[model samples]
Target: MTQGRSIRLFLVDGAPNGLLTAEIMNWTGHVLTGPRSKLSELVQRPECGRTGIYFLVGTDPDGDLRPLVYIGESDDVATRLKQHNRPEEKGGKDFWEKVCLVTRKDQNLTKAHVKFLESLLIQNAGAMGRCKLSNGTAHEYIGLPESDRADMAFFMEQIRTVLPVLGLDFLRGIGRPSSNQQPEPFTPTQPETYPLAGAENPRLKMEVKKHNIVAFAQELDGEFVVLEGSLARGEWIDLKHNYRHLYKQLCDEGVLVDDGNGFKTFVRDYGFTSPSPAAAVVAGRAANGRFDWKIEATGQSYADWQDQQVSAAAAQSEEMEPT
Candidate 1:
């Protein structure tokens, strides 16, 4: 009943000489690191790799101790345990921080003992999936895997089912949900425009088509922006990652007229199909986004607004920075 009391069990098997180890210890006591021997000599070699399970238990401050199980299917059980025992990676986690390495002291573990241990852990681990008992409790089998894929699925399902039975509450850990928080009002930033100035040139001719492919560039308060082409579903894509590359490529092709504000704008005459769905999208967004965007208000198109931004940015940069 002491807070320090806890039990840890391990099912060790690999190639030939496998063993089952279990121990009881205090929460603050030294935890076993890992098995001393290699995995090939531990569990008998199966067709592919090897598999085993580890179980640890410890009392909380209130002296309630329940076993926590970690299952594994691996080529090297000992090596994996060493990784978990280290304090840097998984070792830092609470469940792994106090691992009790287990080994059978009374008798060398046989195949029966390993199977029995696996069944015992599974029965206590969580809800039933499958199992078989052999030799009147000397051996047990749950058809669990010796691979990570099957073992992880089996154990996670068990833990999910058992944690609730242990009376552990996680949702209530933080403050309870509240309904009184007031919604914050949103204020729009500057406007959005298409075909920012220097984005498309007079020489660039676009054909009129049924599909609306409104391409535009704009300048606003000393900013340059450009967008053109059709949207899949009236949606816009953020190309920030490729902005620099796209801009440099465009400039190299003579699509960009100026570069300032740290990032360069597209510099070439990238053509787009005509008719322009962008006009409609920009018009719709104009209701929400910044910019005096309106069919009647600004008497200008989204493409024009974009051009204005670029022109303004170029003009301001020229005025401020001496050549």
Candidate 2:
């Protein structure tokens, strides 16, 4: 689990989607984020002149949810951004719509330091398989002094934490667990080990005994988690073509393996953005997880419990308000 930490974000233009800056407590790193339209305004900031690593972000022209991203390090961020902002005929990036850059607030980073950071970031962004990276060149590792390497590694962690807060999750992991995170197994008989607290983010289960479909899931840390070994229907009717492709991709990637029982079983715990998509994967058809995924003990559907929770919170909040 990610340890709790505080992050501070400032709106440079007083608009939520306009030029913005962010910082983490006890961290000496500074982050600058802004939309493509605000490029001129951002270049005026002092951060633009610093040595830093920058990312250019844009939606994929192919309509894939994964956006296109380019990572680069520059001794002068402002100058680099200016070049990218020029018209395509003048060699500017045409695909990027937003930009984020990271630099040291204490002004201690050297060209080597920023190069190391750039190489590492590019490698990770490509490894995540989340977005298409613009850099065609493979990263060339840079050697750093032992102490400096430790410091840079810590700086990268801070960057990882701050990027998600600014709405870029390309660095967020999927499919594989971090080195420190151990995988937990899911077993039907040991259901007690599951997340059990109902009325407060309860664990949910969906099973069609006749179809031999059984799955367990919960929402955690902004993700809908379906545990490992959960059974999924091998054949789904009326499944959208893209969702079908998604399942096949999961299978091809070995996240889901054939169970030899006409079903696909999760080889490891999988997290989905929401229950509906998770349920649809398990059912091999379109599914409403809110109505179909049920609390194992109470037999209440997730939709019912969610309604009750919302109503309760509203009533409690009303009681606390001053008359």
Candidate 3:
């Protein structure tokens, strides 16, 4: 369980897109954010003179729509930022567009402290798989005193809590079930149903079954999750589509395995950007998942269910209006 956090953000230059400063309630750490265009102005801030860890964030065109980041730490963050902000031809980088740095408000963070923070951060970000890391080397562990280590760990915890609020979430771990967890724990055997928490609504949930093939799907957090044990078509018709690559990647990654019959069976849960793509890869051709999926309990189509939900919401809104 995670406790709540109180983060105070100051929008420097009084604009959201410009420089920004943030700090957690009762925390000694300070976070500063700004665009590369304003790096010169931001570097002048006092926190930039302190030893700290920083992230250079930008998008990677070849990375399948993932953000790219270069993580580094320096005794004088401002000087390092100045060097990086120079042209790539001049011992600088060319990819970053925004900068975010974390430092101690009291300017007491040391090289060893930031080094440990950098190594742990890189490892966790790599595990998250949400971004393309530009860092070519990892920092070796700089062992800290047991007491200072505990304090740094808590500092990292606060950094994690505030990162997502700043529109960065590369450190969030993907949802994965444990090894002993059943693939179809919600429903098993013939006519299996993969129930997801808060997804009981027919409009947003359904199971696809064709002959002996069965699959379950639900929308969560803007992504479609296909539960384990879901069967996919053994072959694909649109080989050039992006979903085809995705299917291949899933198979290569061992998330999907051959069923020994003529279809693909999911060994673990997987997430897709949308329902149609998920259904297409699962059905081996172009498919409209909105119409193909049906509620196991009522046999209602997702499209119809969605219409009913919209109508119900409008009616409720009308009822609540003052006459």
Candidate 4:
């Protein structure tokens, strides 16, 4: 044959949840018939089209992996290799290392599959997606090598085999199944309520503490203020709307008082400022500020307030939707 043919093989082990897997992969290797060797030689040759290998670990956009780790392709193989092996150097974590350890200890995986995996990993450099195997968890990109098509075929086969193992072994940190459904539309019970005009919920509960603070300072205080936190932790905006308009409203209403260096709120007379201690506290207490604070006039939660805004926006959009 003048041109080498592509060969792909796949095997899945265990039940509905795969315990193990294996595959036979051959791509674009020059036709050679000596003891099935020269595989290494084929890998070395650039013309053979060994395009390298990569692993795509499935993850949410936020970079959390839950289900399967996919091995595939790359252009800068050296960088990809370092990315997988050196945890701290590459984002302080390495998922490939974890999977390899498990595979090493568990002989359930086949020799061919193992070789495919080992070569695929050793050859590639950077990894795409989350590395749950690593201590720190986040999605990342890997640099792959340029070689031949054969390597690509081999790596893809290995990936196919390994994916089944995730389901069977019940890997904890693997990303959710690729087939998992997207979230349904969010429907709120009430949408007409707004947050307390101003409140600072600064108890620091970890979940929505920052949001509460922003809600309090921006929505309630009606001021344009920038809050700085720990450097790496970054900053957050309390109010989602236009800070300048809110600031103008507060200034025009005389609710914001300039105190030499910066500004503070005189919320008692201002309708925009929250009536409570902080926005965080209000958010934590109830979804709707009106109901949570017992502000009988609104009879709604912060969530309800959000819903009302969304509904109004949607209505406006519909009216403007080319009718």
TM-scores of the candidates in the order shown: 0.20, 0.78, 0.72, 0.20
Candidate 1 residue spans exceeding 4 A from truth: 1-53, 56-68, 71-77, 85-95, 127-323
Supply the TM-score for candidate 2.
0.78
Compare candidates 2 and 4 on TM-score and give the better one.
Answer: 2
Lowest lDDT 10-residue stretch of candidate 2: 186-195
lDDT by residue for model 1 (157-189), tens = 333323332232110011111234432211112
Best by TM-score: 2
Order the candidates by lDDT, highest first.
2, 3, 1, 4
Q: How many residue pairs clash in all the candidates, one count each?
A: 47, 0, 0, 61
Error (Å) of candidate 3 at residue 121 is 1.3
RMSD of each: 24.1, 6.1, 6.7, 19.7
The runs of at least 3 residues in candidate 3 whose Cα sits more than 4 Å from the true structure, single-residue gaps closed, are 1-4, 61-63, 140-142, 176-213, 217-223, 228-236, 239-323
Those runs of model 4 whose alpha carbons end farther than 4 Å from true positions after fitting are 1-116, 122-126, 133-323
How many backbone overlaps does candidate 3 show?
Answer: 0
lDDT for 251 in candidate 4 is 39
| Model 3 error, position 286 (Å) | 5.2
| Model 4 TM-score on a 0 to 1 scale | 0.20
Candidate 2, superposed: residue stretches over 4 Å from native: 1-4, 86-92, 136-142, 174-203, 239-261, 297-299, 307-323
* Displacement of the residue 114 alpha carbon in candidate 4, Å: 4.5
Clashing pairs in 2: none
